[model samples]
Target: MSRHRTIFRRPILLCVDFDETITVHDTTSLLFQLSSSSASTQQQLVTQYVDEVGEFIGSYETKWRQRELISSRSRTFDDAGLHEFLEGYAAVDLRSVQRVVECRALEGIRHQDLVKVASSVQVRSNYAETLALADDWKIISVNWNKKLVESVITQAGVVHEPTQIIANDMKADQQGVTTGEINVKVQSPMDKARWIDNVRSMYAATKPTVVYVGDSATDLLALLAADVGIWIAAANTAASSAKLLHQLVENYGIDLHPLMNCGSVGGRIHNDRPVLYTVTDWAQVQSILKSPF
Candidate 1:
């Protein structure tokens, strides 16, 4: 459970990324494997979706790199058209793969198996254990499958409203296979921020503060859009959130501690940079939120 330092007087909306921010491994990848397809074939499809399609989901590369590649194809291409093409291609690929997986349905995987997968995979410590306490935190799944993300978190016994999770998904059968047409909601990183803004407008009267947490560059736009943006760098990895923020701060020439509401919030702002916070795990994040200690 997240340690409570002090009670919040205003509504707090946590806009979080689902892929690697909460779960240790990518649940989308795991969902693809459950249709009884061979491991190699599953990996091939996932690889194509990430590499040839979504620019590895903006992990090793940036969104600008994706635009550069697109611009190379046709300098005169329309921006809106390119965006649509990329998103459409991913949706088609994902649906096509789901169809193929359903055709096989030889795994005999039951819904119970999803719980096992959730347990087998190492979560970020108490991250899943502290969900309900987050109130209206939304899981912005940038990946292709929402059901898979929901399944893992649901199996964790973290009860949350349906509106809290935004992602793509397909209906599942008794065999634990995707048996319906895919529903694509969020296709790009920009969509994450856009959705949050939309949600904010819905609860505008409350004047909630949006706190976005994510792990990859795919979450760049949303993180920057929030009142408080957090980067959850992989543990012991060189791509620590602090390092990434340092780079962004240097590149954008922005200060850490902005002039407005500077010291009233939780966590410390080093040398007056951005109102950014970096924690090794979810527990620390909860700790930082409750108090400035």
Candidate 2:
């Protein structure tokens, strides 16, 4: 007797987040630190603000409420005021900034092992093959820095088409490069979600199978909107908001973080919704696609 396979007819819309999800380092933060003259000081200030905001957001029962409050205040807080608040209240680590910068600067530095461990990274495990397998696929690497998206596309050896990219800045040009553009400065998480929703609606068709892969809590709203949601685990430290979101998902009987070290895979159904799978290797992902769970 042969078992029947559920074939996915709709185009697999892969909406991937840039930061820690695709790139080994957070390119937006990297660019911010690199662009800043007072890199060390600025990094500390930013980190502090992030921590404080994260803590505050995590304290709330509904994360969306916290996001709304932040968005409202962000409009009032000028760049300088935001910087000051971060420095005073958040207490960021300068080392993290320096490390990110160093990692970004290193040429030919591929986190092959990490890439091998997590199938989420854009370049790893024969991305071209996966792209070819899908009937139709579009990769949206969302981030505040557009340059990072360009850099990743260049490094991945994939054709960079402007219609394929969505980012915040136009400070840098992808001239003579094939890459799509959706210029919108993503100052806050809400901005990110809004852009994602806009993109989804713009490309709306008959029950499009949208998949969103992200590594931070900022991506939670967009992920929730997607037909399939993938949460990529960050190295070392877990972003506070993301951890809280994971806990909330767990409360609903979903195991967001399944793999312990790496090279493990597990998934579970939540509320009779889409199957949430934790993948640690690109090879496993390929295998899954070849013969889906």
Candidate 3:
């Protein structure tokens, strides 16, 4: 059982990340691998590009640039050309590694081991507990893969209308070919902040307390914007590398010590505004919410 607080009359706007946050593995990569046999090779190239450029080259601009660059050697931007361009740049072929990760993740969920472990630590089951908590709050998933998040929530027994899921819109042409490659037009950090602002303004009369729960640095902007920021680290791994990198660049100071620090477990308040808490299990999240604010 969980406890509820009455002082907070404002509805909480709960935002979550999709990849590695809710699901154990990135679903998009899984879909790509399952979609085609050459998916592995394509994914490898993309990974290399992202690693070298520090940005996903799934946009029209990137594609155009790649096409132009390869035009001298190849006449068309076919699969091979694309692969070659990608191979010249990405870090790792995430698609190749997704299967093993997804399998392990599904096993954990199917055996109820994750839930059991979470319960042991006093954290409620993520899907169930979150569903229960949604009764009073507006829960939205800010993820790169909106459809995948929708599927997860639906599978969890929660009915979320299409409009409720916020993400970058992907459209394909009539030829059944993706007009533009899969790209995150609105990034997680930007979207989280934008959504929070929108919710705050829309419900200004009620002045609801906004809370954002996430496992990566992509959620940092939203976390900072929210009344509460909850960081979940089930394996004691910090998932804020992107944010840390941005911070380092902005500060122009490179002392790897702070970035490498994993810090302690469990959630706690920070900066007097948004409460910062970390949990190894979701049950701890439930317990925290159950505790008096």
Candidate 4:
């Protein structure tokens, strides 16, 4: 399943989104589970997260309708507009992180505690199999703690370790207790795109082909930045994450093409008309990446 750089003329760089993309469930709740807070306190934190996100979505929907009405006369997919639209989500995302800090939800949690919660996180079906095809693997996420992402992947029996993880760090004391202050780095879709470019730069000499697989709105920018973008709508979460993705695609008229065969990978960014391949499961991803596409 390994790729030979000499024969391929370039390496394969697989960048996957964490949370609902790789895992069966988003790890946001798992982060809270690390804290020894009473069940009621933990529920309060989770409820806050849900309320804020819901409010943001409500506002976003209003704006979405206005845009739809504005474009009713002539409708064509505006790739650049879609990029701008998703970038605006950064503020809401950052606000959520700030609220978590203010509430001290993660404070007092130890690193080892995170490892315990990570063990319960489940990887999507066939994800590890598809991951083995890459010359290098990286997890790009907006999740508050990087260690949780690493631990989850390690526990999932993934033999190929992630070369890099682009995510926020949880500040911890010498005694390993979380300070509740996140050293925020990745928060926006733009941030994800920037980090992916940083990773791609490391392989400038090889000119590796970059493939990004993601599931939510936060992953939109990074998906477009790669040579091949895969939107895996998890069966369990399709009603929410998948619906949001579909709404964005529909509202903006995105050029989403169904991936039918193995040789569907693009060579470079299709700026003129960006195309994102859609998939329902990791087995499809494995089939697509079994050979060069």
Best by lDDT: 4
- Residue 129's lDDT within candidate 3 is 73
lDDT of 3 at 88: 32
TM-score per candidate: 0.65, 0.57, 0.56, 0.86
lDDT per residue for candidate 3 within 1-293, as digits (tens), equals 99986675445555665555566644544334323235455565556545534444334345555545745332221434333433432222334234323322211121122223322222225645764664234444434344445556555666666765666533344544333234344444555677878767877876655656666545655655666666655463443343432332222211121211324322323222223455554555554344333
What's the CA error at residue 161 for candidate 1, in Å?
Answer: 1.9
lDDT for each residue of candidate 1 in 1-293, tens digit (9 for 90 to 100): 88968744666677888877887766665655555557776666556544544443343236445655655322232335334433554464556556445554324344555556666555676776445445468888766556556677776777777888888765567655555345567766567778878888977988877778887645766766777777676765555334443444333323343223344555423333434545557765574355421
Off by over 4 Å in 2: 1-8, 54-58, 61-132, 138-142, 170-193, 205-207, 234-244, 251-269, 272-275, 287-293
Residue-level lDDT of model 4, residues 1-293, one tens digit each, is 99776544367888999988888777787777677556787777667767766786777688788876867421566666677667656676676677778877778788888888787787788887788877878888888898888888778777544457878888989998898889988889898999889988988988888889999888887988888889988665456777777777767665677676536565333434567887888888776566664
Query: What does candidate 2 score on TM?
Result: 0.57
- Tens digits of per-residue lDDT for model 2, 131-225: 45543444554453455565665556666567666665433233322122224455344555666687678677654556666666556556555
RMSD of each: 8.3, 11.0, 14.0, 4.3
- Global lDDT for candidate 2? 0.48
All models: lDDT? 0.59, 0.48, 0.45, 0.77
Which parts of model 1 are misplaced by more than 4 Å? 1-8, 47-116, 129-135, 171-176, 239-275
Candidate 1, position 275, lDDT: 46
Better of 1 and 2 by lDDT: 1
Scored by TM-score, the top model is: 4
- Which 10-residue window in model 1 sums to the lowest lDDT? 72-81
